[model samples]
Target chain A: MSEEPSPGPVVDAAFFRRWLVAAAAVIDREADQLTELDSPIGDADHGANMRRGFTAARGAIEKEPPETPGDVLAQTGRHLISTVGGASGPLYGTLLRKAGKALGDSAQVTPEQLRDALKAGVDGVAQLGGAAPGDKTMLDALVPAVEALSFALDKGAGLIDALAAARIAAQEGALATVPLQARKGRASYLGERSIGHQDPGATSSALLLGVLADTAEQSAAGGTG
Target chain B: MKMLINVPETVVADALRGMAVAHPELTVDVEHRVIVRRDAPVPGKVGLVSGGGSGHEPLHGGFVGQGMLDAACPGEVFTSPVPDQMVRAAAAVDSGAGVLFIVKNYTGDVLNFDMAAELAEDEGIQVAKVLVNDDVAVTDSLYTAGRRGTGGTLFVEKIAGAAAEEGAPLEQVQSIARQVNQSSRSFGVALSAVSTPAKGSPTFDLPAGELELGIGIHGEPGRERRPMMTAGEIAEVTVDAVLEDLRPQRPVLALVNGMGATPLLELYGFAAEAHRVLAQRNVAVARTLVGNYVTSLDMAGASVTLCQVDEELLRLWDAPVATAGLRWGA
Candidate 1:
């Protein structure tokens, strides 16, 4: 795990803010699709709950901006946990909160730090949800995305390229959930009947990672400024 | 659907406001959505906390009084309450005797309560949990999220709450709760689909002349569906389902519960049929509770829960109790 003096921009609080703002936008736009995915096997509120949580998080960040990357994510996680009332609340909240804690009050974080932090977050999610990659949960997408990012960064890829790889891995992982039987959440109650429907949690996870990749690309191009 | 609600978004809040006005003995925190007994943190008594989705009224919130839960956190309809609510409840009700969380086995409730227990324990409050998973309708536990905690929740809450009320330690309270959950079994039959205010329509479509067997409290799809049957036939099927899972050697406490919309007239008739069937099977009845104790919102259905009682359990069951939902002999 060499540091190799990476050439990509080090992410700061502003970069994390842009990523979350864009994430909220994408979640709002795709809320209906997420809810539709949930109808077959879930309680059909994943979309609404995510929309409510992210929108509230976005508002909180804008109302009182944070000073560091860790603060931004930790505050967002707290808001999501309070606002999103379901199994997703704790799972998603733990993902960000644990990752933010791993960020450790750093004002700026390198790609390697972000990667390790997200790995920590995903690990927390697995512990909280007691789910694994094939459980037809968000972990299906998140675990692969973090691994792809870690591998790309370890190979000296630029942050933008590494995040792009992560996004693609996440998307593929979400698609992979369609044929697997759910073992965890509300969907598991359906047993075999849950096989055909893509998990809404994994879909949302992919969308969040995609937004992060896009944000990285935009920052690299000086577009976010 | 034309529900008697101001708007779908405020349904839970509005109901809480109404509950606050109606129940002066309870300290209702409308903004935070945690309901506690007016006199909470009852000295050295073990604190019992239970909650889940809001649609199942009188399940958690209404049962938050003298002989039951010390606090109840109501979430949005068919949604689990977040850990913060549970943490706040534990903080408000813990009186140094430790707290026991009586959780349903739904993935949402389980996850939230697990987090809450961790958070509370981190704050130096000793915590224990007992998960109620008594629905015999769910046959597999290894592959699925285990059984749906349905009507049997009332038995666990009431019986364990009684034990807690009598100055039982947290370990004893939690053990009795687990024992109650182990001895109980439940099965529900839905005559119609449930309509949540958020969905503004039936959560699942159940056509006329059709019924769902083994319905979860949240309207999750059950074991099977069939054409409608009489109360007698429904009772036979429902009772048999519970009996198959619970081969009771002792007399049992029976709960003939209605889903939100069924009237007492029908529930009583169904209860009579259930009693006749139990008698024919040679299982004595120690006591019976027939009403809308645990309900799916506006769903025309009934669930039967039977808890086999030994001498100690029968004594606890006969204890005086007072709650908004269940009160007797106090």
Candidate 2:
């Protein structure tokens, strides 16, 4: 059996902001790949839409850095909603905004706080998009991330450990969308033809969770070293 | 993967610029991606606004002018425009009477337009919405979301734009638009998939010998794929599908639209076959139009839209309209 790692420290507002910016870059780097996957089922604009949205979010966050982690996420949400111009915009925006609201005015967020925030974010997305788990949307990734985060927190894991768990779950969720027959969005109009393709939204959502894991790990190493 | 474009990022802006250069009467807002009539929101007239993804050129944008849309917000290719753009459009086009939003029934389009209407209402502008869900290929059953909004948008825009231009109240224009939408049916097929400029690849894989039937506008796979058929057989299948969906008992206005790559010659051939099939079924063809009114980038295919016409619809169809993409009556 492999040895388990120790829990890490809490994450602060600046760390969360950095993670948001890094998430944008990750999306930019992987955009062409997302577009390629979308070519088989969707209009090949997922990359362009995500790039525009995250670019705007980065700009907004940099201009007026948030005092709290929640504020940073809220600003990101607003930027995406105004600029992305697609189904992804409003859906992803709702996710960030709702998560941020749950974080409240706290400058630093603990693992349990982050878990609650993710739950709020998932709730917001469901309310705004009316999409459930098997709909082959961002919700697929988001639901898994939330479940993993909650499970880690219950086990007394720290921020870094929980985020790592969330990242793994999110990636698995994204992969699961490949064989799903889309029941929502424009892809659903294709019926059986939509099967055998990965969902672009779920892929992007997984990247977001992965970014969080990377940032938390880096922050933890910097703090303890 | 061939496309006629200068740059990927500037496609919509460049197209709008070309429109302005080509038509001096229509005012184009390069920043907002909205095209408006030089003199819009005619005093005491209900303003009409319609828009969608940018690739369906000569649509919401082309239909903006004196007798059609007062304004149109162009989104990025195959993406819905945000609520802020629609809100700005509503504000720019709102007269005292109110503003009418003619929206396609796609989820993104519906949600964004609904948000914009709410924003406009909050700003003291009265607004009404009419969703166009005219594609009969997909069903609006309990199991599925519903039929997608497709080709018949042009018919609704033309007729309702005319009604609005003639000083109809916002409610009247919206009601008439809904009536037209309810009476129309559209079905499409794709011979080849389209390529996005940024992606530089086809949206789907279609073998040389096969074609996708019952396709939507965004290059989404159709209901079925089968071996390629002759233009005559294709038209028969398309017309038969629409006829079965609408089951109209009256005269109909037929629109045979190309999916961008199909040339006018092929469209004419398809229309000829469509006409023959309609005649055999005893379906009266009141008016016929064949062109690339709505397209899916460079996809090689065509769609058939039929609107059951009454006296009022026929009058609206003949109404004088002027815009950058289409023009009639000097």
Candidate 3:
């Protein structure tokens, strides 16, 4: 693959902050949709829960202003754990905190470093929720998104292109959950009835990845100037 | 929506405040959302901690007292409480005999309580967990998240709490809790959909002239929806569902519980039908409790939970108990 002239924006603390801000916005916009999806098989609280968590995470990051990308993620994870109520709180909190810890106080992260950290984070979520890729959980989107990011990065794709690829993979992963039975979380209680309804967690995970890609693309465009 | 609250945000807090005033024997923590027995850590007695979403009133919280739970963590409506709340509750109630977490088997409740047990263990407190997943409405535990813990939770809490109150060790208490869970089976029927405070609308739609069989406490749709049945018909079906799973040779403790919005007038009338069904099956009833013990916040329905109890469990069940939600022989 031909390399782009610019490597794209530096993955710094500010970039992570911007991604979280954008995430909060996206979650707020999609809150109703998420709750609507949850209504059928799960309790209708995923959208409100995510909105509360991401909003708190964004606010906490803005107020404290962590010096490193790792600190931002770790703090955001802590905030999500405390603010968001339900399985999503601990699940998402574990993902971010584990990823942040893997980042190891790094002042800046490369796309490759971010990929490895996210892989660790996704693994943490699987362990915390005891769910696998086909469990109709957030891992459906997250596992594939992280794999896509790693694959694209290994194939020498630029950060923006790789993130865009990850976002698409995540969206596909969310869509795939529509046909599978939920093996974990509230939706699992529905048993066979859970089928045909998209998982709210997977949908939100895709939204988060999409927001990250959008933020990265914007930062890269601004960085070119 | 259109509920009796100043605002949706303050509902849990407001209820906690009301509980504190009404039941001065319990220490209510509004900010941290942990309620403990006023005389907690009753010196060498094992601590029993149970909690879940706020809507299930008189459950984890109201059950807190001398013979039931040592502490209860109340979460937002239909949402599991965080690990911090559970950890704090463990610390406040642990009296060197360790603590047993009586967790309902909801995905959020299981995950949060599991994390809390880990956190509490990290703090040098011995912690054990017994999951109550007695709802037989959902048949496949292997494929799904397992059975949803419904009305049987009360049976576990009361029996296990009695054991703990009698100074049972954490291990024995945990074992008894697990045994209670194993012996119990529940099935719920929803005559109408439930409306949560946050949504201000019905969580699910159960059209008029139809009812949901095997409905979850959180308003999750059950096995199937059928035309509304008479109380006797509903009772027969609900009790039979439990009996088929339990197949109890011994006498059983029967709890014909209301699902929040249901009235005792209807519940007792329903309980009589349940007794008739149990007699028809030749399953003797040891103790019968009929009320709104575990509820799903205004979802006009009732659930039948039958626990096949041995002599020891019967003794524990008859033990003196004093709590805000239940008190007898104390």
Chain B TM-score, one value per candidate, order as shown: 0.99, 0.97, 0.99
TM-score of each: 0.94, 0.96, 0.97
Query: Residue by residue across A1-225, what tens digits does model 3's lDDT show?
Result: 245636677888898899999999999999989988988888788898899899989988999899999988888998988878799999999999999999997888988889999999999999888899999999999999998998988888888888999999999999999999998888887878889999999999999999989988899888731
The docking category that best describes candidate 1 is medium
Model 1 gets an lDDT of 0.90
What candidate 2 gets wrong by more than 4 Å, as runs, is A1-10, B140-143
Worst 10 residues of 2 chain A by lDDT: A1-10
Best by TM-score: 3
Cα lDDT listed for each candidate: 0.90, 0.86, 0.91
What shift in Å separates residue A145 of candidate 2 from its native position after superposition? 1.1
Each prediction's Cα RMSD? 2.7, 2.0, 1.6
* Local error of candidate 2 at residue A150 (angstroms): 0.9
Q: List ranges where model 1 is wrong by over 4 Å.
A: A1-10, A154-156, A223-225
Q: How would the docking of model 3 be graded?
A: medium
- Residue B182, model 2, lDDT: 95
Q: Candidate 1 lDDT, tens digit per residue, B1-330?
A: 899999877888999999999999999999999999999999999999999988998889999988889999999888899888999999999999999998999988998898889999999999999999999988878878889888889989998999999999999999999999999999999998887776667767788999999888887778788999999999999999999999999999999999989999999999999999999999999999999989988999999999999999988888888889989878
